[model samples]
Target chain A: MNYCSDCGATVSLKIPENDERMRFVCDTCGMIHYQNPKIVAGVLSVRGEQVLLCRRAIAPRYGLWTLPAGFMENGETTDQAAAREAHEEANATLRDLRLYTVISVPHVSHVHVIYRCELVSDDFAPGVESLETRLFHEHEIPWDELAFHTVRKTLECFFHDRKQGVFPVHNLAFTIALPT
Target chain B: MNYCSDCGATVSLKIPENDERMRFVCDTCGMIHYQNPKIVAGVLSVRGEQVLLCRRAIAPRYGLWTLPAGFMENGETTDQAAAREAHEEANATLRDLRLYTVISVPHVSHVHVIYRCELVSDDFAPGVESLETRLFHEHEIPWDELAFHTVRKTLECFFHDRKQGVFPVHNLAFTIALPT
Candidate 1:
């Protein structure tokens, strides 16, 4: 944001005469640059009685377990992104994926969309970003070793919904505590 | 991302010859840098027959209409983000914001999580990031003036679901054409 896209001039943060907050405005083109948060989408692929999980091959929370998920790419739909992530992380194809949960982590400026996907086939293995991939029954979930809070929340909601058989049509909320 | 967070030294993305993408050795702190896509959450506030829409005060699409939404902050859940956005943009409190749509726009690297929020109060004015705010009935919606593809799709889904009196429980695929 140091340089202006409209003109090759340096930009400055200023409060507009009509506005109270300061915005980065280009003196040359009078353009105001506003940056918004990004969205992350993934799938919770499930076999009859088991859920698919991936072991991370990269850092941040490497060696930890997680569902197949990734950032949404341009021009692709959410379902498409979910399917793509499933293919990339586990080489799994999904049939019906229901909107499971939407988790927001404002501190990191991201929104996570998790889908409950029915596994179309048993064909799966670790992909580029995954070290290992496996299926875990409800009782066998690696709860303590799960990589992110959103993943944990999604699983919790899924199990709760499965039990209630009511499968709430409404969205739920939870908080994630980051390690200080 | 190949750098030491502690000592500011360069790191490598390569895994040791024998390691199966499991171990990432940092040249400095020897710490692995793990990366993951973030989550974003927002609300689709509906007031009776009309839905709340905001004109973005910032770019990528400045002055374009959109739902009140933003990225999820750390420690906050998706539902929290949705409520927060609704308050922030429309100054409206929501009750029973059912999960409406989860759109993954891959090309832009974002997963849009939209909730169908019930407007609790009519006390709303334009927020800081909004050029202007207004409510539009289904037929009066400025579809062509929407800021993002995901927003458009979510609204369309809302109407479709409203017609059937059946809110979608699953994620659906949609393609958004780039503006000509």
Candidate 2:
């Protein structure tokens, strides 16, 4: 941050008194600007043996397949955020929402929380941010075309657990791969 | 926020195109400043049959009892944040950390994530932000003097689950009650 949002003054990175970490402190107002990891909430919407995926029309992985997910907004529960992402990306409604995976991506400062829920019906269409929305069975999933590691991991766990007829909440962390 | 953190420009609240929420838009640079909920991570550090508690030495509930938790910072996983909080507030080290409760306090735009862990040793003292730090048995807990609802809920779940000999992760939400 070059300027302070609170006072419109130049901000300098410095460790405040009684604090160990360096923060963006305003020169005029002395306000500390803190940046935290964000939550990306979505769902694994299922119908019979199929799971929903949306083809993104936006940048950063456009045209790639992903589970409907986005940065969670303020004033909403994780469950609510997950449900809203489903509706906003695929026009899908969900039932019996249960927390599934909470994956921490420290490199990107994101915690992706995915829920496993049943599709309300087979009726769903691509929302504005999606080029297309469709359901795919385990065998038909575009594994290589997946947009993110979080989506790929969640799908892999879902299919693996389906065989055992039991699903458990998974806590995972992702580290960025360094070039050898 | 009154000014853009990117450019030192005055900002106005407006909904940008293709967006549903009102966000701070810079008048000069047109930067969109979006705000989201933050995660507060802490630990329920247990030693024998007792859990650790810290008396606040800061504002918003100074002198009240609470678990060692604060706003999670960037470049840390939830588990790491929880561990850091315990050490920072109570000077306590933990082991066998497990995800416990994920509670959404939407009214305040905060998600409290508590982990259940075993205390490494009985040697713990109050850190700078804590007035006092001590282990408290179930019967000795100061229920009426608890600082936040999230801390109380996690402790309640821990004590109740102790009887069943199982500690399943909990997903919960808290709504603010309007005063009559």
Candidate 3:
């Protein structure tokens, strides 16, 4: 941060007392602007034998397929965020969402927590963020065209668990390769 | 935030294009400063029948008992944060940390991601944030004096699951009492 939000004073980067990391500290107010990773909550929703997927209308992966998910806003629980995202992206209401996969994407400073949700009904249409929304069976999933690794991992685990007749919570981490 | 970090200009709180919520958007540089919930990663470490606890030396709950946990820093995974918190709070190393409980405290804008860890060795001491560190058996736990509800929940789930012989990941949401 260039200036403190509290006092509008210029900020300096330094390690605070009893701290190991450097932070944007306001000289006047002594406010330490600490930046932490964000939580991205989403759901891998199901309807009959199909899984829900939304085609992105936004950039960074426009037209690519993904589950309905987005940034977890303040004052909302992770599951609440997931269900809201479902509505925002696909106009879908989720029910009985179980904690499924938690993935940490350190390089991007984001964590993905996906829930296995059941669609409340078949009434769903694409919201503004999605070009289109559809459901896919296991054989119809566009594996190579998926938007993110976390989504791929969650789907793979869901299918594997479904085949094995046990659905244990999966925790995984993904690190992007540093540019050489 | 008052001033934009990108251009040092005053930021206006407004809903950006297609965004549902208001964000601090810089008029000059067009930077949408979005804020999201953070993750607090910690471990419920065990050494045989005892679980580790650290008495806080910091404010907010000075001298109250808690697990070794803190905010998940940037560029590190949640597991790494848990491991680091273990070392930083209790001067202890951990291994075999399985993801146990995920609790979202939306009122505080934080999610607690806890793991069940094994103490690497018996050599332990308090770090700067902890006044004292000790292992507490189930009967000796300071239930009334715990620092946070998330810590209490994790410990309760651990003991309950231990008795049940089935350790499934628990997902819970805690709401702070709204001011009247």
Pick the lDDT winner: 2
TM-score of the A-chain for all models: 0.87, 0.97, 0.96
Error of 1 at A29 (Å): 7.0
Q: Show model 1 residue runs off by greater than 4 Å.
A: A1-33, A166-170, A173-180, B1-96, B103-114, B120-166, B169-180
Question: Could you tell me which 10 consecutive residues in candidate 2 chain B have the lowest summed lDDT?
Answer: B171-180
Model 3: interface root-mean-square deviation in Å: 1.4
Docking class of 3: medium
Displacement of residue A75 (Cα, Å) in model 2 is 0.7
Candidate 3's C-alpha runs over 4 A off are A27-29
Interface RMSD, candidates in the order listed: 8.1, 0.6, 1.4
Write model 3 residue lDDT over A1-180, tens digit each, in one string.
688866678889999997989999988899999999989999999998899999999987999999999999999999999999999999998899999999999998889999998998989999999999999999999998899999999999999999998889999999889999
Predictions' DockQ, in order: 0.23, 0.89, 0.72
**Candidate 2 residues A47-82, lDDT tens each?**
998999999999989999999999989999999999
Candidate 1 C-alpha error for residue B35, in Å: 15
User: What TM-score would chain B of candidate 2 score versus the native chain B?
Assistant: 0.97
Model 1, DockQ value?
A: 0.23
- Which residue pairs show backbone clashes in model 2? none
Write the number of the candidate with greater TM-score, choosing between 1 and 3.
Answer: 3
